[model samples]
Target: MTTLFISDLHLSPNTQDITACFVQFMRNEAIHADALYVLGDLFEFWIGDEDRSEFALLIKNEFKTLVASGVPCFFTQGNRDFLVGQRFAKYTGVQLLGDETVIDIYGRKAVVLHGDTLCTQDTQYLEFRAKVHQPWLQWVFNKIPMFIKKKIVAKVQSGIRDEKEMKSLDIMDVTPSEVIRVMEAHQVDLMIHGHTHRPDVHTFEINNHPMTRIVLGDWYQQGSVLVVNDSNYDLQTRPFFNQSI
Candidate 1:
């Protein structure tokens, strides 16, 4: 059986190509996998619960179909779309996974993340994360009306754009020290995540043993997927349908 992992689709009303690609991926490539792990950024913005969007309905249909077809789906929140919760999970037939969580992947211990925290250099974003992640704050925010939340989110997105404009690429990317720290803290050499949109499989030494960090690509010019079956793992990238990366 094979398990698949992907993230940073950043799906939105305007991202029709990515959405169409995703729909096909679920219908064909991902439908038969043993499990599908979406590590987050599934939407460019998810302002409210899953039940609110027809887009969610489109996504739910595919995921529910997958569950019915026997492939379980799992999710983790990213900086942009961490508000996904039980309501979305139930509607989509997927389980919401916690940040910095570990699981047995084909009998190997694998630690998964959305990868925003690894960008330790983005101090402002980190601070924002701290505030938004407070349980009390999240509860209060989730209770707000969708229209109000959308207004707030539009502001947040504008702020994010400004940050990207001002920050250097290195500042917005993962810090090597933080990656090592997380791997060591979790005691897992295999760390897989997506967020920075820089995809690669890097090997490094940790405690005198080989360690791997797999960065999943954001779906922009192309889509990437890592397939793991038993003791085998393969990272593949291709031009999206008729486009190039």
Candidate 2:
């Protein structure tokens, strides 16, 4: 059996086509996998676990179905969906992972994360991430009514879009030094993550040891999946086609 990984779906009410693609993936591909790991941005934005919108319920049902079929699923919160809490996990039966986690891949150790923290040059985003990840701030934000929270999220997203346009590509991408540091710190040769949206396999040396970094692509144009087993791994992209769901 092969372990599957995906990230940056950014599923939302506006992207019904992408959502359908994801639903099909869950039903057809994920059910047969050994395990599934969703790296981040499962949703465009997750306001709170209390979100019971139709879109949220649809995604939850898909995860529930996948888990019920005997395949284990895991999730790591992305910059957009960091508010996903225990309530969401309970509903979906998906285990939530920490920002940085290490696991055995077939036999070798591999580190998995959402990958935003590796962009050390993006000081603005890093600062914002620090502020938003505060437990006290999240507790207060969660107490707000859903309607108000939605407005706040919209305003924040708008600001983010404007800021992103002003930033350079290099600033937004992960720092090579940071990547080497993280891999060395974790003592892992393989690292998998999604956030940069630049999907490709990167090879280099860390203290004379070979290292591999796999970046998962966003699901804006196509569905991206990484299939891994004992022998090797394949990164694939599935185009969205018009099909009855």
**lDDT by residue for model 2 over 122-183, one digit each (tens)?**
99999999999999999999999999999999999999899999999999999999998888
* Cα RMSD, model 1: 2.5
Clashing pairs in 1: none
lDDT of 1 by residue, 68-180 (tens): 78889999999888888888788778988988899899789999999999999999989999999898998999888888888899999999898799989999889999999
What TM-score fits each model? Answer: 0.93, 0.98
Once superposed on the true structure, which residue ranges of model 1 sit more than 4 Å away at CA?
A: 241-245
Candidate 2: regions farther than 4 A off: 243-245
lDDT of 2: 0.94
